[model samples]
Target: MQQPGTVDEVWPSHAPENYQCPFCDMASGEFAFPDNLCEPGDLVYSDELVLAFIASHGFDPEPGHVLVTPREHFELLYELPDDVAARLMIVTRDMAVAIKRAWHPDGVTTRQHNEPAGSQHVWHYHQHVLPRWNNDGLYFTPKRPIVDPAVRARKAAELRAVLEGGPTRH
Candidate 1:
């Protein structure tokens, strides 16, 4: 596993001109985001500005991890508009609370990566809201493979139910 502060060696230093941003396509509903288990309709929460869904990649420590992103594609933190960033943060916080209530994990973590050197595999800006437990070894272990799509869709539905039920308290 790559250290928290170090870049992944294979990550590109610059965005290639031909690089088709998956997030943009996902936002446009061009297709299901490649490798993601949840479809656009499976989003747990969405508004005019943001969307939240269960992540395809599962951290070994937690299976029902969630990702929150702007409806508009922002490739990096620097490129994100202030208003969208603020809205995304709010959604991230709300999703963290909902994840905690729905999954009942010991704790919760929210993470965002900037560029290749920051260990950002995806070019689009997003926040990962993960459930955590003691000694889960998140930074020390490799991320688990994508969970089964049916399972992910079910997880997304569960989270969506929680989110729809009412407001979440920290």
Candidate 2:
């Protein structure tokens, strides 16, 4: 399917000059950037097309928030090819299930942002899979401090184990 919009006209990139995309780095098995909060052990799932990992920043009382992103760089949702967008959505659904199985949250939510006005700091396209509970106030509360790597790793492991040998899709 054609992209819904004229990407060039509707979605301008926000990346800075000489931008080193952290998600691309993580997908390629590199996480050495000093500014990047993601770590090697934070990855929970991967395939030829996408990667899913525990986010470095999370809401209070819920630290295992997940991000599903395309292996290739796509600055905004309007830029994704149909196949990449399909795979991204599939992985997003799988990550949400994994979160439910691992964390047993009262509920779950997924969100994607496109531009600066939409609060998308990262230029790459990604979907957030967050565990939700009643009265959690996820939208109002600020993200908690950068989570410790060890905790993130553990959370990743939990979801990784749950997803291992779980599904195979192309």
Candidate 3:
């Protein structure tokens, strides 16, 4: 399915000259998330098309946050191919389910940002799947800081086990 706006329309370029895309390097195994926040062991799910893993940062009430991204670098929602978008959505759904099973959160939320105005920090496209609860206070809070690598790895393993049909908390 096509996105809301014209598929061929060009976006006002916001990228700087010689801009180094961090997601590209991460996907390519060139740069690792600082302090091992995201390591290969943190990968919960992946295929030839997409990668799903625990994000470094976690919301206050629920720390079982995840991110699903295209294996190749696509800057924004409008730039992603239809097939890639479909795959990412599927992975995101799977991750959401796994989070629910593993963490037993009251609810789940999926988020995607576009350009800088839309709060897209990293240039590469990604979908955030987070567990949520009523009155969890996430709405008023600032973006959470990156958690310790050990915690991230443990959470990743829990979600991966759930997704893979291995032992899980629930």
Candidate 4:
């Protein structure tokens, strides 16, 4: 059931004091932290409203997972504008197609989290686009370490190449 609600009543931000937002840094082309997981090289796609990049962390046996997020920093889904939300979905779907073209997996999966209880680690709202194979165990697998920059870059390059070929055909 859908519950109509206001942002304040439904979503409370969980960011710590003086938190350095990694997604914002990536969106701004300023991935400037020594320990930040995301890097500029991980970026696969970006428009005025959204950005898609390979996730630094990935599920085992299914590396190079992608994260699609809005350009602005919205700590939780409750804060996203309707237009931003629509753009996120559009980008998410395109990333799925790109992943399919690049990896040829059996299928694709999309996931998003809200608060800590909902498994959201980063304060930014992101939708995950994961390529799925039978028995991949994605739901059961914990995230692996932050992938190496070169590897992430290679994956990003693959997706970017696919996306650059223009919109996918039906």
Best by lDDT: 4
Q: Per-residue lDDT for 1-170 in model 2, tens only?
A: 22224433445679999888999889888676778888988999999999999998888777779999999999888777668888999999999888889899998999999888889988889999999988888866667899999999999877776556343332
Q: List, residue by residue over 74-110, the lDDT tens digit for candidate 3.
A: 7788777678888998889899989889888888889
lDDT (10s digit) by residue, model 1, range 2-57: 12121112333356776666666666766644653456665688788888887767
| TM-score-based ranking | 4, 2, 3, 1
Query: Which pairs clash (backbone N, Cα, C closer than 3 Å) in model 1?
Result: none
Per-residue lDDT for 47 in model 2? 94
TM-scores of all candidate predictions against the true structure? 0.67, 0.76, 0.70, 0.76
Error of 4 at 3 (Å): 7.3
lDDT per model vs. reference = 0.74, 0.84, 0.76, 0.85
Report the C-alpha displacement of residue 105, candidate 3, in angstroms: 0.3
What is the TM-score (0 to 1) of candidate 1? 0.67
Worst 10 residues of 3 by lDDT: 1-10
Candidate 1 Cα misplacement greater than 4 A, ranges: 1-13, 32-38, 140-170
Write model 4 residue lDDT over 1-170, tens digit each, in one string.
22244333545569998888899989988778656888778999999999999999888786889999999999888777778988999999999999999999999999999998999999999999999999887776778899999999999888777666643222
